[model samples]
Target: MTLFRESFATQQSLPPWEARGVQSWCFLFPLSATAIQRYLDEYFNFAHPEPAPFRFSALAEAQFGCLTISYYPVIASTNKANMLRYGPQTTSWDHLSYNEMYVAAPVLCNRVTPDNLLVDRQIVWIQPVVMCDNSSVVFATREIVGIDTMHATINLRPGRAPGSLHVDTQFSGFKTFSPTTAEGPLPFLHLETGSPLPGGLPEAATREDKAFLEGLFGVIGGVDLVGGVRPTTTRLISLKQFRDAYDLRLATYQAIVASTATHTDVSDLRFFDPKEVDLDFMWSASAEQILSSFLQLGRPGDEKASAPHEGPGWDLVGRQVKIKVAFAYTNNAVYDQIETLHTFGAE
Candidate 1:
């Protein structure tokens, strides 16, 4: 076995992070494919063989409406030995739990094998924005794994109806586009889901629902018909890089990392009708500038002009875009691990 060096400060003791009883809510919506591609190409530093070992793209121009917003009620490292390794200080800090939310789009990562012979292709989620309430999680996920994670205030509470949830996340950003505005916690995204409809899958499927399910299963993979269940082992890809301390323009280290999270026990697998979903996004100059693609706000000078609304952003109601899928599940004994798929800079 190859032993690795320990991390510094808060995350030093916990090498491999694990969680228990992780409950998650997932909502899927349609997004412009061209916009997704443009975002990946410009921000993620993706290119053909030039970025070297790997190339990535959306699953299909038309079939890929795989924009997803996932919320985790709490994420904490539950390993007893890792917690108490260095005694009280390590135990106290390592056990902190936090709420997290991230927006991602499914894409295909086509990579050249280690032998430099054939190409290996796989489906992975390219996460553009990941926010959590805990600083430790922010540092570890960003510095250690290259997950471009940021700190945010995440609130999860029971909705007005039974067995429903409302989640809202805020991050520091310019409330309005002006020199007078100061950066502070502003609205980022909001989600309100009705009670989980009592069913496995909707029997009377609309064209929109069918398209949504097909796009979902494309990324989810593996369905057990006999058992009437769909199990998922999600693999996420991230471009981890560090800029030179002296010259910010130069990258000291850069690599493409692939991470895995598996649901060992999944329960309460239920769906939500389109009518039951209410999702909203507010324009925070800090977060939304990069997220406009996922939100389907067309580029500048486009005929679809921006309609002014209260505050800094325009209101995006769920029904206007026709939300495809809404569901929630509980998973116990979830595991997370990462591996470097390709390194482009520094030994």
Candidate 2:
């Protein structure tokens, strides 16, 4: 019958990933695909329009503002000199890596109906283009290339049409009837085999068969067999009808305000804010410890950090600490942006 029923019947066991995929497909299958596709096309088209400055008052006024930043994590170098001198505690002395970043554009869909459903539905389809080094000189060059990830946030307000009401009623009753056959009064009489009694026909046949025929055509209580006419001794039917009408009106109004939304972002594109908006005693203490460590044993420069020192007792730690902190702050800002877009509306 339905795809859901067919899937349920045919599919036996499913892996977690497969199961989730199936469920997602099932959920989206009923929706208009053309509508969704068009929505996506418009969403990206609107987002990628000539980069112009945009501002949201609510976000700008907030403590975090619209600013987001991120830092790429430092990868330990395989160089022997680096391992001997800094090892795990090298800080800025370690090789630096950077994460990719992007600014987010907000898209709003208002007063959306079934006809307007596609307008907000397309964000789910937008995907990020994947990138990787392919040069022969690089050791880790070849990698899968396609859409790597995306970040999306959606707010929905679902609504329904006006003045629509639905109602249903059920009736169950039993009636008595007689038969003319010699085997008379059986629940199911064989119409062809049953013989008619003498004197034109039996009384049972006359009365019971007549009643059965009349009932079959819906003629009860001497009213027209097809037309409905109920005998009433009260004057409340009009009020009941009014109540049903009001309920329908209320339901339609309520339906207009319902909605669904989703937010998602890819990991590679994740970014965070580097600056600390609020600083407490703990953060100050941590900063002091870091600065103290840097001043006590910091490298003079990147060259010294990368190269071997000749002095009998020379320590190059300060320069490496500064480099590490810079990288850390950058990555932190990038990660903050990612988190903001991910949980942007949560706060």
Best candidate (score: TM-score): 1
Q: What is the TM-score of each candidate against the true structure?
A: 0.80, 0.16
Best by lDDT: 1
Tell me the lDDT of candidate 2. 0.19
Superposed model 1: Cα runs more than 4 Å off? 1-8, 12-15, 43-50, 61-93, 113-118, 203-205, 224-231, 298-321
Q: Write the per-residue lDDT of candidate 2 for residues 1-347, one digit (tens) a residue.
A: 44333232222211110000000000000112333234334322222223112111111111110111222243332333333333454433434342222111112222234453323221111211111121210121111111222211111111122211111111111111234323211110000111111222122234634443343223113432122111111010000001136556421111001111111221111111112111111111112332223123221333432212223212222122101000011111110110011111111
Off by over 4 Å in 2: 1-70, 74-98, 109-347
lDDT of all predictions: 0.64, 0.19
lDDT of 1 by residue, 1-347 (tens): 77544445644324355566566776667767777777667645554225657667667833344333344444556455444555754443554467888767777667666676536777777777788887887887888679888888888888877888887777877755788887777667676778878765554367766776766675566664232233456687887889999999877877788887676667667777767777656554565465565657533332342232344433322112456666666665444677887777444
